[model samples]
Target: MVQVMRALRVSRFGGPEVIKMRQIECPVPQVGEVLVRVRAAALNPADWKLSAGLFQSPMITLPFTPGFDVAGVVEEIGPNVTGFQRGQAVIGWTRRGSFAEYTVVPAGVLAVAPANASFGEAATIPTGASTAWQGLFDNGNLQAGQRVLVQGAAGGVGQFAVRLAKWKDAYVIGTASTSNVELVRALGADEVIDYTATRIEDAVHDVDLVFDTVGDATLASSVQAVKRGGTLVTIAGMPSEEKVQEHGINVKSFGVVVTSDLLQNFSQMVDDGALRLLVGATFHLEDASRAYELCQGGHGRGRIVFTVSK
Candidate 1:
């Protein structure tokens, strides 16, 4: 008999109400893939966004699991795969099906789990940290000693951005609500603006770069916070060409691209005590719909994760 595992599946685009927990066949690893018995998984905005029918793509099909960040033990490895073995602890980013007892991960995105973190903590690193890394360094071209302002500093990606910017010796300023001001400061932000108390443009200006994790009108107004020759990078939404021309500064946007090398570097950082993953809340696999509700409501202080197994 084929092995089966419990999975959170979505057959339609809607809200948390559409999510259904069901048992599905355990996937076999294909070439260059590894079968992971998922111990934990982190939730991202992309998970809910994808579930709501946004970013519709040809690759997505109905009745598929929705999750990206994963931390687990390698249960099996496919042909031609090397450098990993059965029962090794690992973390990876998958396109889909991470909210399950078992998932098949593309080998290119897999990495050894950090020795210092629990599986739940490790699960929070992939999507948020990688997005922060790519946004600040790859797209924004942040430099040491420069002033960088991060909107939504207490969020999953925002907190990582603040810490990583500080790691690079940049002066980091962050915006958060009153409750998160001290939280942002504890993450190494040089300055923290309470967005609830003051407007961002008035509170921050002349920064070398503005990293906008909050998009919409917030992203549109971020141009005002950056210096004339500065850059603005957002993961939420891209500003239009008109805004770019009017602002006269470089503006870019990107989604996270998980790589083995990046994940390994993150693991080393965790082991060396240079980085941390903050999990705001956690739930069992059966409570995934409620987890989605919390995340979608946008009230969590950090990443929300699902603990599949101990």
Candidate 2:
């Protein structure tokens, strides 16, 4: 008899209410693929945005499972797969289907989970951490001794940017609500600005790099904080190229790209105790709708996870 597993599926895009947990046939891995028995999955803003029909990309089709990050155990390996074995703990990014109890992901994207991190903690790394890393290093080209400012520093990507920039020897400044000021500091930010109180432009100036997680006005304000030749990297919205050219500064926006190398580096940081995972809350797979609602609620200090097992 074939076994089946439960997955959260959205037949139509709309609100959090569209997500429904249902039983589906478990998939078997194909060549160069591994079937993961998902232990945990992390909720991200992209999950809700995609669910709400905000971000439409050719890579994501309708009537799909809506998770990008997963941490679990490999249950099966497909033909020609190497460097991975059944029953090994792993983490990776999935195009879709991670919201299910089992997902078939490319073996190349899989990496051994950090020994010191829980499955829930490891689940939070792929999308947000990779975005923070790529945005800071790849797009912003932030260097040591430079002053950096991170908007939404209490958020998943923002918090990781703070720590990663600090690890690279940058002087980090961050913006968050007054409630999370200390949390931002603990993440290695040298200065924490309360966006509710002081204006971001007024509090920070001569920044070599600005990592903007909040789009719209916040991204616009970031341009003024960086020096004339500095860079502004946005993960939120694309800025006007004309506006950037006028400022004599570099401006770029990025979408997170996942690969085996990126996942491995993230795992190494966690293993070496250079990075910390912040799991704000967990929901059972059955409560994935609630998880989406919570993520959309918009004040979470860290990643919200969905547990598929245990």
Candidate 3:
């Protein structure tokens, strides 16, 4: 008999209403890939945006699943795949889509899930945490003793940015709404500015790195906070090229590159308590419509996760 699975499908592109639950075939792992029995899947801005038809990608088609991150147990391995066994817990960026009871992930991107984190917490890493990790270390080249600013410090990626920067011994400043100011500080930000009342550029200056998880207006103003020679790395919108050239500073907006090394580092940090994760809300697979709605609503405090199993 053929096997089937439950998945959140986007049959049409428009709004959160486009997403619905559907019964689908359980994907089989191909060579260099593994089929994961998903425990949880986390939402990213791109996920909902794709549902709303915001991001352009030739690969996106109707009746597709909408997720990038997954934490699950390995159910099967494919040809030429090694180092992973059936039933091993793992977390990864599937890219193909993960909002399902089963999803196939490339073996190269998979990492052993952090033992200390629940599936929900581990789910936050693939996209959100990795984005923060790469922005600071890969793009910004932030070093110990340097001063760094985290834009939207109470956000999913921002919390990871603050914790990771501090673990590297950098002096970390964070911008947040008043409601989350204390949360950002507790995450180890050396300074937390309530962005609602104070503009980030005015409160601090001459930082070595500005790690922007918030873009647009906040990112535009954040440029001045960087020392003339410092770097501005944004995961959100990009600043104009002309404006960057005039500032005499380095600027980069990078897509997170997920490798076993990067994933392991994030897992190790979580295990060591140098980093932590939070799931602002969790919905079962059947409730994905509501999950998509909340994620699209914006200004959420934690990662939105769908607990697919257990």
Candidate 4:
């Protein structure tokens, strides 16, 4: 008999209230895919943005699951798949259907979960960490001994930027609210500026690289923080090319591209104790809507996860 599993899905674009938990037939793995018995899933701002009808594309049709990051045990492998076995712990981004009991993920997108982290913690890595990794190392060209400033350092991607910048041996300065100042500092920031108390323009200057997770005025201010000929990388939005050239600063905008190589590097960082997952809260699979609500509430200090089992 075909099996059915619980999934959180939405048939229309709207708020968290639109999501519904329902039983759906389990998906089968295809070539180069693996079916994961999802133990946990992480929430991202993209989840809500997509749900609210932003970035609509042909790939994302209506009545879909919103989660992207998942950590789980392998339940089955598709034809020609290698390097993974049933019952292995793994994590990756599935384009859709991750907020379910089982998700079919491309084998190349997954990596073994870190030995030190629980499924909930591991689930938080794929999206936030990979975004930070791409923004800092791949695009920003952050180098050791260079000064880097991270705006919004308390959020999911921001905190990972803090840790990864420090791991790269860059002198890191981060801006956060007063409540998260110490949290950002503990994540290896050499300096923490409370944006609530001080203006970023007044407090930080002469940075070699500026990573802006918060856009708008914050992104605009970042151009001024970097020294002449320095780089400003924004994950939220691209700054104007004309504006960048006027200041003689190099500017780039990035949308994260997750690959096996990136996931492997992140797993290695976790194994080496250089990276850590900060889970702000966890909800059961049935409460997936509430999890998304908490994430969208904009007050969460870190990643929110949904436990699929146990």
lDDT of 2 at 189: 93
Whole-structure CA lDDT of model 3? 0.87
Query: Relative to the unseen true structure, what is the C-alpha lDDT of residue 119 in candidate 1, on a scale of 0 to 100?
Result: 96
Per-residue accuracy of model 4 over 221-277 as CA lDDT, tens digit each: 898899999999998787777878888999888778888778888888888887888
What is the number of backbone collisions in each predicted candidate, taken in the order shown? 0, 0, 0, 0
List runs of model 4 lying over 4 Å from the truth: none
Give the winner by lDDT: 3 or 4: 4
Pairs that collide, model 4: none
Question: Highest lDDT, which number?
Answer: 1
User: Per-residue CA lDDT of candidate 1, range 184-302, in tens?
Assistant: 99888999998888888787888999999998878866888888879999877777778678778888887689999999999999999889878889999888789989989875677
lDDT tens digits by residue: candidate 2, 1-310: 2289899998899988999988888888888898999999999998898889987789768788878899999899889999988889999998757988899889878898888899999998998889999999999898999999999999989989999999999999999998889899988899999999999878888899999998888977798888899999998886677778777888888778888889989899999999999988899978887888889987778789988885
Model 3 Cα lDDT, one tens digit per residue, 2-117: 29988888888888777888898888788999999899999888888888888877887787888989999999899999899988999988877899988999999999999999
Instruction: Return model 1's CA RMSD, one decimal.
Output: 1.3
Cα-based TM-score, every candidate: 0.97, 0.96, 0.96, 0.96
Query: In candidate 3, which residue pairs clash?
Result: none
RMSD of each: 1.3, 1.5, 1.4, 1.3
Point out the higher-scoring one by TM-score: 3 or 4: 4
